[model samples]
Target: DASRIAIRHGLPNSAALPIAQHKDYDRMFADIRDKLHAKSGDPVKPEHLE
Candidate 1:
């Protein structure tokens, strides 16, 4: 199932997640936020989100 899902998504089989352990969602979100900030020159502060 994992391999099939990966192939359907055009990703390597290794990209599939294991059943035992999951990924760090918070860290992933933070990394995405940082990348977006770097590319957009947008402020990430609470006051700036308004």
Candidate 2:
């Protein structure tokens, strides 16, 4: 289920590892969404971390 969700959102399969190990699904999904919208090669801003 975790892997499926990750792949659906265009995240690497490995991204589901921490979710399985630590169960931090909320953070993982939020981080993935942030990264998806971010431009490649651009640095993450402080607000992005929030």
lDDT winner among the candidates? 2
TM-score of each: 0.29, 0.28
lDDT of 2 by residue, 4-46 (tens): 8979998778745665556577677667767668644566678
The count of backbone overlaps in candidate 1 is: 0
- Please list the C-alpha lDDT of all candidates, in the order they appear: 0.61, 0.69
Question: Which regions of candidate 1 are displaced past 4 Å?
Answer: 1-23, 38-50
Q: Where does candidate 2 clash, by residue pair?
A: none
Report model 2's TM-score to 2 decimal places: 0.28
**Candidate 1 clashing pairs?**
none
| Full-model lDDT, candidate 2 | 0.69
User: Native-vs-model 1 lDDT?
Assistant: 0.61
